[model samples]
Target: MREKLGKISNFLVSLAAGIASFVFTLVAVLVVTDFNEKLAASLIMGLFALLIVWVASEQPNSSQARAVSALIKRLLAVGSGDLTSPTPAAVRREMPALAAAVDNLFEQVRSNLDNVHAIALYDPVTSLPNRVHFKREADRVLKARGWDDGVALLFIDLDGFKEVNDSLGHAQGDQVLTMVANRLRIVVKAETREDSLAPPLLARLAGDEFTLLFPRVREPAEAERIAQSALVALCEPFEVGEQTIDMGASIGVALSPRHGTDLAALMKAADIAMYHAKESGRSQASMFHARMAAAFEEKVQTEKALREALGRSEFELAYQPQLDARSGVVVAGEALIRWNHPYDGLRLPDSFIGIAEESSLIVDIGDWVIDGVAATAARWHARGMAQRLTFNVSPKQIERADFFDRLRAAVERHQAPLRMLELEITETLVMKCGDRVIAELAALRAEGLSIAIDDFGSGYSNLARLKDMPLDRVKLDRSLTADVDRSEGALAIVTAVIHLIHGVGCEVVGEGVERREQLDLLRAVGCDVVQGFAFSEALAETEFLDWVRDNAPLRLLPRSA
Candidate 1:
């Protein structure tokens, strides 16, 4: 095109010059020759001078037109995807100035296209692949035998996201989400192998929801390991702005061709596994299993029933007397929780304590135990029975923020003296969060309530910790006391524990003292209290009160050695 235009322009210029030269020559000839010689001679000299000047000026125009034509050709070639064109040396001086601008324009166009595509395929906030693009790519890969060997899909949902959002506001919640997304990305990238047929893809499906697709997993174990890694990654605290928030994710895993063959089925299986993870306990990962579905459903029903049980007041307390070893008199009674399930008859703590602990319903159950025991103690005081009342406290109850306040209210409501109430905590509870538990125990002690370390020797028993704790008594665990007479080792340990506890200014209570030899051993060891079937099993409130009345210490003579 540039060549054709150049030809047309040159021809027009040549024609104009040719016409002028011809006219000038004709006039020169007419003057120089016999026909008007003076006029012709003057015209010929003027024409020759003009021709020289015109030729010199016209040469630059032709050269300029040729340069422009070459430049136009180079530009057209570049635009048409023919980058092999050698830059015309003749036009380099001028064209080089425009070359960089053209190159930059092309670069800008490419960059803009890349940005547009990125926005379409990724979540703006997290920069994780969005569901739309993930599904599209996954489907393409699946169709092309991308997952022929093995692939695992994990669907992760944040367990306590709603609680965080509700307590901290949406801004903090969003920051947490972003942190979680970053963590997921790092975990997936680290676990995925570079040489694998297909690498893992991480996507944020929606609010507090993320998905990971691990293509070309070496084995099922590999998928499980990756899921576990994801769980561990989420275990750390997320620093969002100034606040440090902790959140956990429940991951559900489904392996392709095993759990399902397609995206929808695999996602469903993963969802089921996720529900199982939540049901078993949040903050864990679970693989798809058919049995887990039924178990998950049962847990839902059980939670609902428990909530209903609370509302219907289908709970009661049973009393177990702690006997003074010397006089065989009841020194105190321990209150035991029993759930009077309407259909299941009566259920013990072993059946419901776990459920209660998980759902935080133990707080209410703990409150009920306190109130009932306080009322029992008040009744005994009114009847002139000067004995203390003891109730067991689980770690959950002791850790509750309102524990002390609730206990105070129960004591006040029933007019029970703090000195006559004892709180029994397990050794494990005290050791789990040692400093805080010790401080809380001290506070309770200062309020005039007695504290006993229950189930001693079963947990991580640090003698130093026990001595430092504000405990009034120590109850030897049943395992140590059960075969005291038969096992010399058991007898020695029991004797040592009793002497040690007494030396620390704390009384010793021997639990599960069923046999005569056990009671005799406990007595010899100087145990202050003995509680078990040796006297009577944990009894109903009425049976206990009746036994208390019949076995009044005043009626029994002191035993002689």
Candidate 2:
């Protein structure tokens, strides 16, 4: 009540000052119009008296102006961030409604900023804190730990997610991703203790990729346990609409101080580890180790060397003789690519083929392989060794837009006999290279070339898919042929494979038959051909020809199909 009375008193004082000024102006005007000395003197005296009265009245209201100044100061303070302090009641009394409105506006602005920060820091889909929040938390916590407390980052990528997206449609794929996100959150929560300092934070980094961070990790086992729990939980089939889907995760774990003290370094190490997991087999996890770093460097070197090797003509094929089981004669040869690196002696296909296939180098390397083998076959044909020459074909090579054209060109350039140039494709190529590959292979077969299923029993055994393929032969994979001599189970598998191959109108070739006993077992199973070290290891063209010349009746003399 006093505050309102003070405002009313100030208003009345201001009104009195205005009235005093108006009376002084009127008296002066009257004195000027009269133009008399006595009248002017009287008017000046009255004006002076009125001015004195106005000054006296205004002096008592000085505190009101001071109060207004203080109110302005308080508003400036609010603008400059003295947020907790409220405007004084005396100053607010000068303008109560305006003061209250300003305070409310400030609060609304602060709230909007907080909400904006949350929107910027969290993922809309999962409602989980996002990469920005993760990095911020990781950086601050890791620095605070100071290499004393442990920190771990788990980088996870979904396996076969692309297939799921492509086959089941993206809506279903998103449902799977959301299901995975929920599963990850639940598992991480269960692993963390109620009073844990810096519990595990699970964030979806991007589509089908997530990173789980454990601050004050304490030990590697904890991270691994969390990883195992998350993976096991994630893989459980998710039901969306009418369908149930199975999923798998590849996890890469990296620890602080050991891997690195920062989020970027830890993430990189974890990514590399995750890649290793995928390479070993998806649905598994690998911890960051020094050896994995070395392996990564080696792979980089191999990629560089492979690119150089192709141009330097450092790659060569070693022909492994495949024999006719019935005749015991070397009827054909499989061309295996070997890289004789100038720095590192000989590198087998297993050592570098994966690297090549992953990079753009595969296309060039594959082209060279096809060309070199075709040229070699031409030479063998000229030497009266008309044995068919088969070469392993990478799926990438076969899936190329110009694969058929390139193969045709290579054969024509070398004058290779189409019937004698066989291409060996893996089971993955047969089953998973999409219909494009199948259609292309069918076209290639129509051109009078033979296509064989290489590493047969080792890959997806889909008979329906195989029936559609134009396969000339099924080379029993090395795994099934390794111990067929002693293991009844092994022999039984080989027998069944041979029967299956024959049923599909394709011949069976036993691979890696290192013993005569294995060979006898394969022959008993009606294997049509065999390729192994037992007969002859892979050799250079000169050595291979020499081997053929020395062995009687094994030489590929001019023979008709």
Alpha carbon lDDT of each predicted model: 0.81, 0.83
Cα misplacement distance, residue 109 of candidate 1 (Å): 20
- Candidate 1 stretches with Cα past 4 Å from truth are 1-198, 201-213, 216-288, 432-440, 552-561
> Mind giving the per-residue lDDT tens digits that candidate 1 earns over 1-561?
655676687677777877777786676666555657766666766777687567646654444556678777877876776645555665655556665555566577667778998998998878889999899877765565554577789999998797678668887788788889988889987886776666777898988889999877647788889999999999898887777777888999998888878898888889889978887779999988878667656666777787888889988888887888888878988888888888999988887787777777878778888889889888877887778888898778877777877888888999988888899988876665546557777987998899998889886787877777898999989998999989999889888888888888899999988887888778887889888876777789889888888876624334537
lDDT of 1: 0.81
Q: Each model's TM-score?
A: 0.60, 0.73
Model 2 lDDT tens row, 389-440: 9998887788778888898899999998887889999897687767767777
Could you tell me which residue pairs clash in candidate 1?
31-40, 32-40
Clashing pairs in 2: none
| Consecutive 10-residue window with the lowest summed lDDT within model 1 | 552-561
Query: So what's the TM-score on candidate 1?
Result: 0.60
Model 2: CA > 4 A from native: 1-133, 169-171, 192-199, 240-242, 358-360, 378-385, 399-402, 412-415, 549-552, 555-561
